[model samples]
Target: MSKSNTNTRTQTRASLFTPFIAIILPVIIASAVLYRLDPLEPVHFPLDKINRSAITVPLLNKNMRLGSEKAAEGQVLGPEDLVYDAALGVVYTGCEDGWIKRITVNESVVEDWVNTGGRPLGLAFDGNGDLIVADAYKVTGFHIYV
Candidate 1:
């Protein structure tokens, strides 16, 4: 109510807020600097540098859904190790559901191709044009399915 009392209250509020700002500003700046120095597993691989002369793998994002979209579509559980069949113009991915899914990159068409009876953990095509599937089961853990 009195002028001296109001001024004292304003000074006290300003003193409290100034210290908070001084403390928080350095913390904010230090956090930014540290993050710029070493952040999480940042995607350092540029899209252009991927799959050219040296052959960049998976950086080719055409109709590719990164991982989540295909996994959601057609029950492609735990899709792993995408092996591109360049000759066939399709990508094959092993899933945890004991199946290999063939995906047409341009069309985004997913087909349930082969079931390994065990979890298809990895997929690759051999020189003989046969798909070599590493099916991992609970007991044995490894089996080659061709």
Candidate 2:
């Protein structure tokens, strides 16, 4: 091809690529600057707790023997937290099936205590034998729709 035709082709190629670069260059530069400022920055969210570092080493097991055993038997799914009640001689565990179950020491019997109607997370007991549960996705036996 001639010199003028080659120049026109080059300009045509540059024009075709210019709009893409115009749209993409700003995003690339902004992302680079944000990453440079804080590479581990979390996105803007309401309940997102960004931890600085993770504790990987096991704190309780320096030279420990790993042991496992079955604790209970029932439809008790997702026991997130367990609290022992010395008065009843039973261990109460909050489950994801919305039931706080009581199990014996020898994994013999499991009983459904109360159905919270939400997935129970944390469990605690007061001095008056009152059990406290941190139920997720529900408030006061009603599911919160957001």
Candidate 3:
């Protein structure tokens, strides 16, 4: 309506845009600088002589694929590693939430084996059906009594 009032409105609009530009411009400049400084390169590691083992699990039915079929027949929460005990015919998997799960492969059943109080990473079975687990926070051994 008035000249001074129009000027004040323009200044108010500029003040709102100024802070948005100030925040966005620095982020764009920093992203450009970082992109130029550290250009990503394609990494190719040749596995010429790496010794590897292949594990084959018999499917419950002929139509089920190996990886596509669920091992535990339920949702696995952050399973990091798995080990199969041939003697006991059971498979153990380490979980992130301080849990070790036991899955009977033949029966397609899963159950919580033990809680380690820390994130379990690696699992193995020692002699006499004892479960050995490696936790994330510490590298100590855990034996679970079946």
Each prediction's total of clashing residue pairs, residues at least 3 apart in sequence or on different chains, is 2, 0, 0
Backbone clash pairs in model 3 (N, Cα, C under 3 Å; residues 3+ apart or in different chains), count:
0
Model 2's TM-score against the true structure: 0.47
Give the per-residue lDDT of model 3 (tens digit) for 19-92. 99999999999999999999689977777656567788886777756566567644568899988888678788
lDDT tens digits by residue: candidate 1, 64-132: 655544333655677877888887888888887777788887788788887778777766676777777
Which segments of model 1 are wrong by more than 4 Å? 1-75, 138-146
Lowest-scoring 10 consecutive residues by lDDT in candidate 2? 137-146
Residue runs of model 2 more than 4 Å from their true location after superposition: 1-69, 73-75, 140-146
**Candidate 1 C-alpha error for residue 12, in Å:** 96
| TM match of model 1 to true structure | 0.44
Of 1 and 3, the candidate ahead on TM-score is 3
Q: What is the model-wide C-alpha lDDT for candidate 2?
A: 0.76
lDDT for 24 in candidate 1 is 100
RMSD of each: 16.7, 14.0, 14.8
TM per candidate comes to 0.44, 0.47, 0.48
Candidate 1, number of clashes: 2
Which candidate has the highest TM-score of all?
Answer: 3
